[model samples]
Target: MTTHVQLHDRLDYQSVAPLMAELTAIADDMLVIDAGNVRHLGTLPLQVLLSAVRTRAAQGKITRLAHASDNCIDMLGLFGFTPETLTQPEAWT
Candidate 1:
Protein backbone atom coordinates (compact mmCIF):
# COMPACT_ATOMS: atom_id res chain seq x y z
CA MET A 1 0.00 0.00 0.00
CA THR A 2 1.01 3.60 -0.46
CA THR A 3 0.94 6.10 2.40
CA HIS A 4 0.83 9.86 2.00
CA VAL A 5 2.12 12.35 4.55
CA GLN A 6 1.45 16.04 4.27
CA LEU A 7 4.32 18.23 5.37
CA HIS A 8 3.76 21.31 7.52
CA ASP A 9 4.42 24.81 6.20
CA ARG A 10 7.27 25.39 8.60
CA LEU A 11 9.45 22.39 9.11
CA ASP A 12 11.68 23.73 11.83
CA TYR A 13 12.90 22.30 15.13
CA GLN A 14 9.41 22.63 16.55
CA SER A 15 8.10 20.26 13.91
CA VAL A 16 10.73 17.58 14.35
CA ALA A 17 9.00 15.36 16.91
CA PRO A 18 5.61 15.31 15.25
CA LEU A 19 7.13 14.83 11.85
CA MET A 20 9.20 11.98 13.12
CA ALA A 21 6.20 10.39 14.77
CA GLU A 22 4.07 10.70 11.68
CA LEU A 23 6.70 9.25 9.38
CA THR A 24 7.45 6.49 11.86
CA ALA A 25 3.84 5.36 11.83
CA ILE A 26 3.81 4.42 8.18
CA ALA A 27 3.89 0.70 7.48
CA ASP A 28 3.35 0.75 3.74
CA ASP A 29 5.64 -0.29 0.94
CA MET A 30 5.47 3.16 -0.60
CA LEU A 31 5.58 6.43 1.31
CA VAL A 32 4.89 9.72 -0.41
CA ILE A 33 5.53 12.97 1.41
CA ASP A 34 3.75 16.03 0.10
CA ALA A 35 6.08 19.00 0.35
CA GLY A 36 3.95 21.57 -1.44
CA ASN A 37 3.17 23.46 1.74
CA VAL A 38 6.61 23.45 3.21
CA ARG A 39 8.22 26.87 3.42
CA HIS A 40 11.08 25.96 5.69
CA LEU A 41 13.15 22.83 6.00
CA GLY A 42 15.27 22.71 9.11
CA THR A 43 18.23 20.43 9.60
CA LEU A 44 16.56 18.27 12.24
CA PRO A 45 13.43 17.62 10.20
CA LEU A 46 15.54 16.96 7.14
CA GLN A 47 17.56 14.44 9.10
CA VAL A 48 14.40 12.73 10.21
CA LEU A 49 13.17 12.49 6.66
CA LEU A 50 16.53 11.23 5.49
CA SER A 51 16.55 8.55 8.15
CA ALA A 52 13.07 7.44 7.24
CA VAL A 53 13.96 7.16 3.57
CA ARG A 54 17.08 5.19 4.29
CA THR A 55 15.32 2.84 6.68
CA ARG A 56 12.50 2.22 4.21
CA ALA A 57 14.98 1.57 1.45
CA ALA A 58 16.82 -0.93 3.63
CA GLN A 59 13.55 -2.77 4.00
CA GLY A 60 13.04 -2.77 0.24
CA LYS A 61 10.37 -0.10 0.42
CA ILE A 62 10.24 3.30 -1.26
CA THR A 63 9.92 6.86 0.02
CA ARG A 64 9.41 9.93 -2.15
CA LEU A 65 8.64 13.62 -1.91
CA ALA A 66 6.00 15.23 -4.13
CA HIS A 67 4.83 18.66 -5.15
CA ALA A 68 7.64 20.44 -3.38
CA SER A 69 7.46 24.20 -3.14
CA ASP A 70 10.31 26.32 -4.49
CA ASN A 71 11.22 27.32 -0.96
CA CYS A 72 11.35 23.72 0.09
CA ILE A 73 13.47 22.83 -2.90
CA ASP A 74 15.86 25.66 -2.24
CA MET A 75 16.20 24.77 1.39
CA LEU A 76 16.95 21.19 0.45
CA GLY A 77 19.47 22.38 -2.08
CA LEU A 78 21.29 24.20 0.72
CA PHE A 79 21.95 20.76 2.11
CA GLY A 80 22.92 19.49 -1.31
CA PHE A 81 19.74 17.53 -1.77
CA THR A 82 17.15 17.34 -4.48
CA PRO A 83 13.76 15.70 -3.91
CA GLU A 84 14.81 12.73 -6.03
CA THR A 85 18.19 12.44 -4.38
CA LEU A 86 16.65 12.78 -0.94
CA THR A 87 14.67 9.63 -1.48
CA GLN A 88 17.50 7.67 -2.98
CA PRO A 89 19.33 5.64 -0.35
CA GLU A 90 22.52 5.70 -2.33
CA ALA A 91 22.57 9.49 -2.19
CA TRP A 92 22.84 9.44 1.57
CA THR A 93 25.94 7.33 1.56
Candidate 2:
Protein backbone atom coordinates (compact mmCIF):
# COMPACT_ATOMS: atom_id res chain seq x y z
CA MET A 1 0.00 0.00 0.00
CA THR A 2 1.12 3.54 -0.63
CA THR A 3 1.88 5.74 2.31
CA HIS A 4 0.45 9.21 2.49
CA VAL A 5 2.41 11.89 4.27
CA GLN A 6 0.26 14.55 5.78
CA LEU A 7 2.35 17.65 6.32
CA HIS A 8 1.09 20.33 8.59
CA ASP A 9 1.76 24.04 8.17
CA ARG A 10 5.33 25.32 8.45
CA LEU A 11 7.16 22.83 6.27
CA ASP A 12 10.75 23.92 6.70
CA TYR A 13 14.11 22.28 7.36
CA GLN A 14 13.01 20.92 10.72
CA SER A 15 9.75 19.41 9.55
CA VAL A 16 11.35 17.79 6.52
CA ALA A 17 13.79 15.78 8.60
CA PRO A 18 10.96 13.99 10.30
CA LEU A 19 9.18 13.53 7.02
CA MET A 20 12.35 12.16 5.51
CA ALA A 21 12.71 9.84 8.43
CA GLU A 22 9.20 8.63 7.82
CA LEU A 23 9.87 8.19 4.15
CA THR A 24 13.04 6.27 4.80
CA ALA A 25 11.20 3.88 7.03
CA ILE A 26 8.42 3.18 4.60
CA ALA A 27 8.75 0.55 1.91
CA ASP A 28 5.60 1.36 0.03
CA ASP A 29 5.48 1.32 -3.73
CA MET A 30 3.64 4.63 -3.92
CA LEU A 31 3.66 7.95 -2.10
CA VAL A 32 0.81 10.35 -1.74
CA ILE A 33 1.03 13.92 -0.48
CA ASP A 34 -1.89 15.54 1.25
CA ALA A 35 -1.63 19.30 1.04
CA GLY A 36 -4.82 20.38 2.71
CA ASN A 37 -3.17 21.70 5.85
CA VAL A 38 0.08 23.19 4.68
CA ARG A 39 0.48 26.90 5.40
CA HIS A 40 4.16 27.75 4.88
CA LEU A 41 7.14 26.07 3.35
CA GLY A 42 10.75 27.16 3.10
CA THR A 43 13.18 26.71 0.24
CA LEU A 44 14.96 23.88 1.98
CA PRO A 45 11.78 21.94 2.48
CA LEU A 46 10.74 22.51 -1.09
CA GLN A 47 14.10 21.40 -2.37
CA VAL A 48 14.11 18.32 -0.22
CA LEU A 49 10.66 17.19 -1.26
CA LEU A 50 11.17 18.04 -4.91
CA SER A 51 14.36 16.05 -4.95
CA ALA A 52 12.51 13.15 -3.44
CA VAL A 53 9.89 13.40 -6.15
CA ARG A 54 12.53 13.32 -8.84
CA THR A 55 14.44 10.54 -7.23
CA ARG A 56 11.35 8.46 -6.75
CA ALA A 57 10.38 8.99 -10.36
CA ALA A 58 13.82 7.92 -11.51
CA GLN A 59 13.31 4.74 -9.54
CA GLY A 60 9.92 4.16 -11.16
CA LYS A 61 8.00 4.91 -8.02
CA ILE A 62 4.67 6.65 -7.78
CA THR A 63 4.21 10.02 -6.13
CA ARG A 64 0.75 11.45 -6.24
CA LEU A 65 -0.50 14.73 -4.78
CA ALA A 66 -4.01 15.49 -3.67
CA HIS A 67 -6.16 17.94 -1.73
CA ALA A 68 -3.87 20.88 -2.43
CA SER A 69 -5.33 24.25 -1.64
CA ASP A 70 -5.10 27.16 -4.06
CA ASN A 71 -2.49 29.00 -2.04
CA CYS A 72 -0.38 25.88 -1.74
CA ILE A 73 -0.62 25.24 -5.46
CA ASP A 74 0.44 28.82 -6.14
CA MET A 75 3.47 28.42 -3.94
CA LEU A 76 4.32 25.17 -5.70
CA GLY A 77 3.99 26.91 -9.04
CA LEU A 78 6.48 29.54 -7.93
CA PHE A 79 8.86 26.65 -7.31
CA GLY A 80 8.16 24.98 -10.69
CA PHE A 81 5.22 22.64 -10.04
CA THR A 82 2.25 23.13 -12.32
CA PRO A 83 -1.42 22.42 -11.66
CA GLU A 84 -1.00 19.06 -13.37
CA THR A 85 0.78 17.78 -10.32
CA LEU A 86 -2.48 17.69 -8.42
CA THR A 87 -4.03 14.42 -9.47
CA GLN A 88 -6.96 13.57 -7.20
CA PRO A 89 -8.38 16.48 -5.28
CA GLU A 90 -11.28 15.82 -2.98
CA ALA A 91 -14.28 18.10 -3.11
CA TRP A 92 -15.65 19.04 0.28
CA THR A 93 -19.39 18.68 0.49
Candidate 3:
Protein backbone atom coordinates (compact mmCIF):
# COMPACT_ATOMS: atom_id res chain seq x y z
CA MET A 1 0.00 0.00 0.00
CA THR A 2 1.04 3.56 -0.58
CA THR A 3 1.69 5.99 2.23
CA HIS A 4 0.19 9.44 1.72
CA VAL A 5 1.88 12.60 2.96
CA GLN A 6 -0.35 15.64 3.09
CA LEU A 7 1.73 18.68 2.22
CA HIS A 8 1.09 22.12 3.64
CA ASP A 9 1.43 25.66 2.26
CA ARG A 10 4.68 26.59 3.98
CA LEU A 11 7.40 24.09 3.23
CA ASP A 12 10.14 26.38 4.38
CA TYR A 13 13.16 25.65 6.57
CA GLN A 14 11.02 25.83 9.67
CA SER A 15 8.92 22.89 8.47
CA VAL A 16 11.29 20.85 6.40
CA ALA A 17 12.83 18.93 9.24
CA PRO A 18 9.61 17.50 10.54
CA LEU A 19 8.38 16.88 7.05
CA MET A 20 11.56 15.07 6.15
CA ALA A 21 11.28 12.94 9.27
CA GLU A 22 7.76 11.96 8.31
CA LEU A 23 8.83 11.07 4.82
CA THR A 24 11.78 9.05 5.98
CA ALA A 25 9.67 7.03 8.38
CA ILE A 26 7.34 5.69 5.74
CA ALA A 27 7.85 1.98 5.15
CA ASP A 28 5.42 1.51 2.30
CA ASP A 29 6.28 0.40 -1.21
CA MET A 30 4.90 3.63 -2.61
CA LEU A 31 4.75 7.20 -1.34
CA VAL A 32 2.00 9.53 -2.49
CA ILE A 33 2.54 13.21 -1.83
CA ASP A 34 -0.52 15.43 -1.78
CA ALA A 35 0.85 18.75 -2.88
CA GLY A 36 -2.45 20.49 -3.54
CA ASN A 37 -1.97 22.94 -0.69
CA VAL A 38 1.69 23.75 -1.20
CA ARG A 39 1.91 27.46 -1.90
CA HIS A 40 5.51 28.08 -0.90
CA LEU A 41 8.64 26.08 -1.58
CA GLY A 42 11.91 26.74 0.20
CA THR A 43 15.34 25.41 -0.69
CA LEU A 44 15.53 22.99 2.22
CA PRO A 45 12.12 21.51 1.58
CA LEU A 46 12.91 21.18 -2.09
CA GLN A 47 16.11 19.36 -1.28
CA VAL A 48 14.32 17.06 1.10
CA LEU A 49 11.72 16.34 -1.55
CA LEU A 50 14.31 15.59 -4.18
CA SER A 51 16.18 13.31 -1.81
CA ALA A 52 13.05 11.40 -0.90
CA VAL A 53 12.00 11.06 -4.52
CA ARG A 54 15.39 9.92 -5.67
CA THR A 55 15.95 7.61 -2.72
CA ARG A 56 12.61 5.91 -3.31
CA ALA A 57 13.42 5.42 -6.96
CA ALA A 58 16.86 4.00 -6.21
CA GLN A 59 15.18 1.45 -4.00
CA GLY A 60 12.74 0.54 -6.80
CA LYS A 61 9.88 2.18 -4.91
CA ILE A 62 7.41 4.70 -6.25
CA THR A 63 7.05 8.32 -5.28
CA ARG A 64 4.02 10.10 -6.68
CA LEU A 65 2.90 13.69 -6.47
CA ALA A 66 -0.84 13.84 -6.78
CA HIS A 67 -2.79 17.06 -7.35
CA ALA A 68 0.16 19.36 -6.90
CA SER A 69 -0.52 23.07 -6.69
CA ASP A 70 0.66 25.45 -9.39
CA ASN A 71 3.18 27.01 -7.04
CA CYS A 72 4.49 23.61 -6.08
CA ILE A 73 4.77 22.57 -9.70
CA ASP A 74 6.59 25.76 -10.64
CA MET A 75 9.04 25.43 -7.76
CA LEU A 76 9.69 21.79 -8.56
CA GLY A 77 10.23 22.72 -12.20
CA LEU A 78 13.20 24.81 -11.13
CA PHE A 79 14.74 21.52 -10.05
CA GLY A 80 13.78 19.78 -13.31
CA PHE A 81 10.66 18.01 -12.16
CA THR A 82 7.61 17.98 -14.39
CA PRO A 83 4.36 16.22 -13.59
CA GLU A 84 5.19 13.65 -16.26
CA THR A 85 8.74 13.24 -15.01
CA LEU A 86 7.55 12.70 -11.45
CA THR A 87 5.75 9.57 -12.59
CA GLN A 88 8.72 8.30 -14.49
CA PRO A 89 11.39 7.74 -11.85
CA GLU A 90 14.06 7.06 -14.47
CA ALA A 91 13.67 10.63 -15.67
CA TRP A 92 14.82 11.80 -12.26
CA THR A 93 18.18 10.13 -12.72
Tens digits of lDDT, candidate 1, 8-31: 999999998999999988999999
Q: RMSDs, each prediction?
A: 0.7, 6.5, 1.7
**In candidate 3, which residue pairs clash?**
none
lDDT of each: 0.93, 0.70, 0.85
Per-residue alpha-carbon lDDT of candidate 2 for residues 1-93, written as tens digits (9 for 90 to 100): 889888777787888788777666656779888887877867877766766776677677777777877777878878666435533222101
- Model 2 quality (TM-score): 0.78
Candidate 2 stretches with Cα past 4 Å from truth are: 83-93
Order of the predicted models by TM-score, top scorer first? 1, 3, 2
Q: What is the lDDT of candidate 1?
A: 0.93
Report the candidate with higher TM-score, 2 versus 3: 3
Tell me which residue pairs clash in candidate 1: none
lDDT of 3 by residue, 1-93 (tens): 989889989899999889989999998999899999999988898778878888888788898889989998898788787766866757756
Candidate with better lDDT, 2 vs 3: 3
> Which prediction has the highest TM-score against the true structure?
1
Indicate the residue-level lDDT of 18 in model 2. Answer: 83
Off by over 4 Å in 3: 86-89
Q: Model 2: how far is 72 from its true place, Å?
A: 0.9
Report how far residue 63 has shifted in candidate 3, in Å. 0.6
Worst 10 residues of 1 by lDDT: 84-93
